[model samples]
Target: MGSFYVTTPIYYVNAEPHLGHAYTTIVGDALTRWHRLLGDDVTYLTGTDEHGLKIRQAADAAGTTPQEFCDRIAPAFQRAWERLDIANDDFIRTTEPRHHAAVRELLQRCYDAGDIELDTYSGKYCVACEEYYTDDELLDDGLCPIHKRPVDHFEEENYFFRLSRFQDRLLDWYAAHPGAIVPEFRANEALGLIRGGLRDFSVSRTSLDWGIPLPWDSDHVAYVWFDALTNYLSAVGFGDPAQDHTQRWPVDYHLIGKDIIRHHCVYWPAMLMSAGVELPKGWAVGGWLLVDGEKMAKSTGNVVNPLDLVDTVGVDGFRYYVLADTTYGSDGDFSYDGLVARYNADLANNLGNLMARVATVVAKKCDGVGPAPRADSPLADAAAAAVAGATTGWDAVSPSRALEATWGLIRATNAHLEANEPWKADPGAEVDAVMGDALEALRIIAVLTHPAVPGTAAQIWERLGMTGALDDQRIPDAVSWGGYPGGTDIVKGDPLFPRIAS
Candidate 1:
């Protein structure tokens, strides 16, 4: 089987986890699960970016050492991931020794190749952004554009990566690998950045002591972006000569927020080219999760804890809202009312209602045993079409669209039941056939939606009396027509989704 590697940007450890962090992590988790469902060897990596001025400041304010502070905050992320059912293959923290070794090696290679140079630079810097802003780029109030916060003026002698030289090279690489960036428009944006000009970016800071010290020069520490970006390669054994890193070197996708597109698409790739590392295969850029039409910020108390959302709605319900309410690449405006509405409509009213109705009919009509769906069932063709839609939608990396396609089957099945009135029919072979088809339709749905709502899928699977692990069931055959054998003991469980009152 071919290998598929995917990574979410290692989160910064200045604060606890929030909805923004959970959003990207969940997308990565879902995609990785999808790959596994297709039987591809998959690796998913996510972790903390611990070495930065923000972390250092936060640590100082907490009256703890930076390492101690990172240790305390890092597990918050891990614990959140665990609670959210994230199944990452590995979690690589920047403070790990492996990460340090890899970052140093990468920096040294670029330095040796003459791409890194000592330069005296002065600019308006945003510690939160870890980026320099020119006069024109700054906001009208002379604040950093991204954070809308004050800027720190600094001048220093530091090492700069020759990013200016890679503009043409980046264009050439994108030319060779068209569609490497998703949402097509985002690719156009990257080209716009290249078509405009690239400036050399500093990769080392002399004043920072919390970061990894450059190998060639002990006095200067690697800048946060330089140090942080290497975690992608460091986790895959890029520094170790004995390890076979090539098997997973080129990742299938790098899922990141749109704010970091310049860093990942431009600066990171240029640094890799300077160090002779292969570039990433693709990037799936996501828009921000907005609260009140503003970006979620902990400083402003606008951040929403993902766990709190879990408490309000079940994990599957929350996941469904996030993945279904907004298109993958578009900004999603979050609201409690919207969440409840989508949950009640899709889960409680549509899929959940369908399951409850089917199981109840089977109990009274088929003696509580699932009947095999007839070959001539009308839904068989509808199921086939839904399956193809879901497969293709996910291939485009659009979870919302995939789920929409899967819900199409649910809507159709409910319509089929309404038209035939299976529950109203007399007990006989005809009623058995009707309820049997509905149960079979649910079996297909469980397989189709497992990636997005795994827990709910498991519940449906056990209620259906399927024996083996839902994951172990092969696709294309499991999801194909007529997988639910007749005469299996079917249990009519509680409502899969309880509606929240308006």
Candidate 2:
């Protein structure tokens, strides 16, 4: 069995889970689900980044201890995932004992390599971001680019990582491994940062009391990136070198937002090199989901609560929009009008309409029993083309493209049914052949679309009288154009997607 590992950025628990957090987790969930359908051994990991200065400040305002605050907010993430049907294999929190052990081991390895050293630093800091910014990075009013608020000046004694020393090594690595950073444009951005000159980054903070203490020195705690990034390895048993992280480590991919491409594509690779570990196979950078041409933010009160959408549109409906609307690397705008439009067009019209029409025809014309498809059906050719297109899109980690390709097959199947009009014909070999071809197309669609809209896909599978877990079906092969064995009972069930008023 081939093994694959993928992760979402561990979300900071200072706020409740938002659509942005849900977006990455759902993408990871969809990719892992796709891999599983291909018969690969997959590990999907996501969790909360509980230990950080931001969390400490939020806890103070709430009149609670940091741990207590985290304990309360962490469940929001887990519950959200559950509600969204996210199939993550593990949820690792930085506060977990296993995670703490792994972080210390990783820090010690880098420390012994002379990559970490004590230093004094002063800069404009954003408490919300838990990061310092240079004057050039700050706005005219000394505000953080992301938060758009005045940053505070802070000075402290801290341990720094010698990131500047590895600039040449990082460039060399990127040279040998092209396309390591996605979209080609993001790769150029990373190269620009490296050529501009790398700066040594502080890895520990003296003023924060809510983070993991430095293993050798308890006076300070590990900074946000160091503590948070370690969750990827720590979740898979990387802390204990003797443990078999070989099954999951040297991760196949790290899915992150485009804003953090530098950290994941640049600083992260350098940190791994300093620890004498192999780098991740790839970095899949995604653009932000904007609302009204602005990035979603809590302070601005523009954050879209994912649950609100889930309540309005079902879980699968929300999942479908996120995966189908955005090109993986390009920024996407989110609007209620857009969601409802997609739900009506793709779900209520295309997929749901196709399923309902086929089942209704089978019930009326074929005594509620599906017949076998003809040997030379045109629907077979369309299914083959759709499968190929979707497989290529998934390989590139573009969920939107994959869904688009899959929907092409769906629309084609609907067109084929329209050309034949099986409902208008008598119950005979001709009607059986046409309806049979449509049923076969539905089967392939159920398997191919299982990753994006799992609940709805399974419903289609059962409506066709198929057995076994829909998720266990392998891709390309499961959708191999002519796999539906006919002469099975078909049921005209309730509408898969009820139309929602705009």
Candidate 3:
């Protein structure tokens, strides 16, 4: 089997999980599921970035040690993933011993390569951002543009990474890998930043006591980028240079938010070059999920608790809204009204209605046994086309496009059933042909759309009297024109997504 590795940015464990966090993890989960359907060997990784100044501050605010605070907050992320049906292969925490070892090794390699050197540094830093910012980057009154807070000035001795030296190399890599950064516009943004100029960034902090200590120089700890980025390699056995890390060395994709495009696209590749490592295969950047046209933030008191939505809408309903409503690489507004509308229109009205209608007709007209679909039916042809679209769309990481394409099959099936009116037609060969085709369409829809709306899809599969894991079925083939078997007992279930009145 071909190999595919994907990772979501390990979340910072300074706060409770929110809708933004859920949005990215769900995307990763859906992508992983799609790859599995294609019969590829996939390793999906996500976890908490537990060691940082932010975590330390959060711990101090809670009157606990950093480790104790991380121990508590990290589980919140794990539990949220479990509740949301995230299927990550591993969750690597930065504070874990394996991660520490990897960070030390990566730091030492860059230092030994003459790219890391001791330097006296002085700058205006944003505690919220955990990075220094130039005067041009600051807003009026020298505040952080993102946090809208005043910046702090400090002078200290630190170790700096020679990022400026690799600007030409990064430009060359991007030139060779045109599609390395996604959303074309974002790629342009990264290129523009590189063209503007490059600066050597400090890689060690003497002022922070809550991070991984620099290997050769014990007085300092590795900074955020150096410490956090190492989690990707650490999880894949990077510290054990004796072992071949080639299997997982070149990550297929790094799914990150647009806010950190500079860190991932610019700084990361430069760091890899310094250490003589292969760059990531690609970077898939997604925009923020805004609430009421404002970014979700704790200070704004606008952060939506993802668990509350999951409880109300159900996991699959929540997942479907996240993937379908938002076009990849664009900001999506979240509201209770919007969520309810989508759940009702797409889930309850379109997909759920199709399943219930098919099963009801089979039970009433076909004596509760689903007849095998006719090979030459028009419904089968339409389903085949929809399945093909879904396969291609998902392969491109366009989840919204994939779901829209899959829903075309749903719409076609609804139209076919309405046109034939199998329930109204007399019980005969023609009626069986129509109902049979509809059942087959349901089967195809179940397999093809399972990645987006898994819980409801699996339920529909069971109601149609199908056996085996729906997830195990291959894409396109499972939804192909002629795979539905005949003469199976049809079981009708309650409305999969009951509509909520507005």
Candidate 4:
């Protein structure tokens, strides 16, 4: 058990929460929860990027100050996370004083290091992304490549970060830290960026009046690059690391969406190195959760409100589909049909049916009491295999694979009961033994799958008649076979997850 820190990119407040936002945050919460189960001291941080041109324009359109606009939009993220049951340790906003101080300190450090310098900037600019593009980089028809919208011609003097100087260093860093990026292929994509060539990026904006001012020159406000990325360090007390952030300096993993890979993988690491901060341990990149074969967009009229999905499938049901259906580093085509199909198969039928049958059998044959399992029960080896598989899958940060491994045990036990015809067995020693093994298996499954479906896990824990808090039980000891003692009252309840209509 060691300190494990994870973070989700501070979401942009230009828009409310959506499927993309929910997917990244949910993955972070699940991964952190698993680390906690291993007894690791964990810090999970998430927040909003409240300073940028998008927000400034959004505020103008809404007829309000930037701060007031942020106040209105920031709480929507917080409320959405609460509804989604995200367990973030800190929720930071770029507008906060701590963030302002951290951003200024970092800008000063880099400027002092000769990495940030004043330069004339003239290019096609995307206000939505706060990025400048060269003619070659823009779409052939003269539009922003990403937004696919026409970019405005702009010219201003701004401070720029010497990103060109970091290409060799970043390549060397990745070579030294081989697993710094997950899914291997994603790392290659980042490497391709470095090998292609690096360019100095603007770090301050003279035209934007809604950002933290440069410490050396108040007229030039920090740009999206400085203000947004600095939130990671500010949340962990960056400048005063020896005081409270020494051990937690380098985060274990940053769960990010693929759209912002350049910002997180290339630019963010270089910024940290320039500031003399330790680089993050790894980046777990996930692709966009596309809706109807297209990225969710208000412009496209295909934006899927994440909370609205909660109305269709319960929260845990929604979490399961996102993690289970989507491969972490690849684009996942999302649809209501796909979500409902996965919910019915994985959560409703496989897991929920197992819970219902086990409790129902126990109530009828064991007088509503959990029976004890012998050390060498029929399900012993299968239980051990499930435990091992789930452990390995989680260590690789694959929640879908982990849950599949845990459910393997449930399926095996369900099959065991079906073959033995435990209900037809004489209701004496035979029935008691069969029910005992199934109950014990359920206990193990609950503990293993808790990270993804916490509320449901807790429910199964209570039904299994385990004492004390479910999370208090340690893994190796808690999951070892034969923990279910006989004679404990078992209260059978409604099905854990009811089947959705087709």
Where model 2 places Cα greater than 4 Å from the true spot, the runs are: none
Per-residue alpha-carbon lDDT of candidate 4 for residues 389-409, written as tens digits (9 for 90 to 100)? 888877877777887888899
Pairing residues by index, what is the TM-score of model 2? Answer: 0.98
Q: Between candidates 1 and 3, name the one with more favorable lDDT.
A: 1
User: By the TM-score metric, which is better: model 1 or model 3?
Assistant: 1
Model 4 stretches with alpha carbons more than 4 Å out: 240-242
Local error of candidate 1 at residue 409 (angstroms): 0.9
- List ranges where model 3 is wrong by over 4 Å: 241-243
Clashes of 4: 0
**What's the CA error at residue 322 for candidate 2, in Å?**
0.7
* Model 1, residue pairs in steric clash: none
> Which residue pairs in candidate 3 collide?
372-486
C-alpha root-mean-square deviation, candidate 4: 1.3
Candidate 1 similarity to native, TM-score: 0.99
For all candidates in order, the CA lDDT equals 0.90, 0.90, 0.88, 0.87
lDDT of 1 by residue, 182-283 (tens): 878887887888888999999998888999999989999999999999999999998878776778988889998889989998999999999998999999
TM-score per candidate: 0.99, 0.98, 0.98, 0.98
Worst 10 residues of 3 by lDDT: 240-249
